[model samples]
Target: MQKVFFISDHHFGHKNIIDFESRPFKEVDEMTTEMIAKWNSVVGENDKVFHLGDFSFLNKEKTKAIVDKLNGYKILILGNHDRGRSRSWWLDVGFNEVSEYPIIYNNFFFLSHEPMYMNKHMPFVNVHGHIHGQKYEGKNYFNVCVEHWDYTPLTFEQIRDSVVVSEEQ
Candidate 1:
C-alpha cells in the first residue's frame, strides 16, 4: 500500500549542518549518502512524502540530483531557506507539489516548515519542522526534523499515534 511520510530539515550539501545539528557524519557527502539511504529504506517509490523545507544548500543541478534519488512522490512545504527558489523551480527539481505556505491535511493536521501557534481551543495539530533539536512544549505540535527521527522519514500512522488531536486534548 502507498503510505504517507513526513520529514524535514535535510540540509543536504550544507557542510555546516553537520556541526550545526551535531549530525553523525564527517562531511556533507557522507551525510547526503546516508540520509538518502535512510529515506529510501522506509519510503517506497509509490509512497508520498511531505518534506517541510530547508531541503538543501546546493546549486539547482546538485539539489535536483539529490531529489531525483529520493523515494516517494515528494511534496515540499517551503521552509525559510527554500525561499531561494521559486515554486516552479522546486517542481522542476522533482517535487510533485510545492507549497509556499502551510497545508491542512485530513482536516486536522496542519503541516508547515515552521511551527504555527496552536492551543487547546484550536481544532488542529501542527506538524512542522525547522528547529533542529528543539520542539514546542505541547501535545498539539509534532516536529519531524531529521535530527529527532534518526534521519528517517516518519509515516502518517506514526505521527497520528504520537500526537493528541485538538479535540481529544
Candidate 2:
C-alpha cells in the first residue's frame, strides 16, 4: 500500500542553516545529501509526501534538481521562508500541489507550515513544522520539522499512533 509522509524545514543549499539550527552536518552539500538519502530510504517512489516548506535557498535549477532526486509525490505547504516565489514556480519544480495556508487532511489532521494554536476543542489535530527544536506539549499538536524528526519523513500512521498513545495516557 502507498504511504503518506510529512516533513519540513529542509532549507537545502542554505549553509547558514547549520549554524542557525546547529545541524550536525558541516556543509550544505553534506546536509542535503544525507537528507535525500534518509528520505529515499523510507519513502518509495509511489508514496505521497507533504513537505511543510522552507524547502530550499538555492537557485531554481538547483532546487529542481534536488526535488527531482527525491522519491515520492510531493506537496508543499508554504512557510515563512518559502515566500517570494509563485505557486506556479513551486509546481514547475515538481510539487504536485502548493498551498499558502493550512490544509485539513483525512478530516482530522490539520496540516500547516507553522504550528497553529489548537486545543482539544478544535476537533482536529494540528501537524506542523517550523519552531525547529522546541517541544510542543499538547496531545493534539505534532511537529514534523527535520530537526525534531531526525531529518526523516514521518508517516501519517506514526503521527496518528503518537496521538493515540498521548490520548490514552
- Model 1 regions lying over 4 Å from their true place: 164-169
lDDT per residue, candidate 2, 96-165, as tens digits?
A: 8999999999999999988888976898899998888886888878989999888999999999999999
- Segments in model 2 whose C-alpha atoms lie over 4 Å from true places: none
Candidate 2, position 44, lDDT: 99
TM, every model: 0.96, 0.97
lDDT for 59 in candidate 2 is 80
Residue range with the least summed lDDT across 10 consecutive positions in model 2? 131-140
Q: Report, for every candidate in turn, its global Cα lDDT versus the true structure.
A: 0.93, 0.92
Clashes of each: 0, 0
User: For model 1, how does the per-residue alpha-carbon lDDT over 1-169 read when each residue is reduced to its tens digit?
Assistant: 9999999999998998899889999988999999999999999999999999999988889999999999999999999999988999999988999999999998989999999989778988899999989989877899999999999999999999887453266
Residue 125 error, candidate 2, Å: 0.9
| TM-score for candidate 1 | 0.96
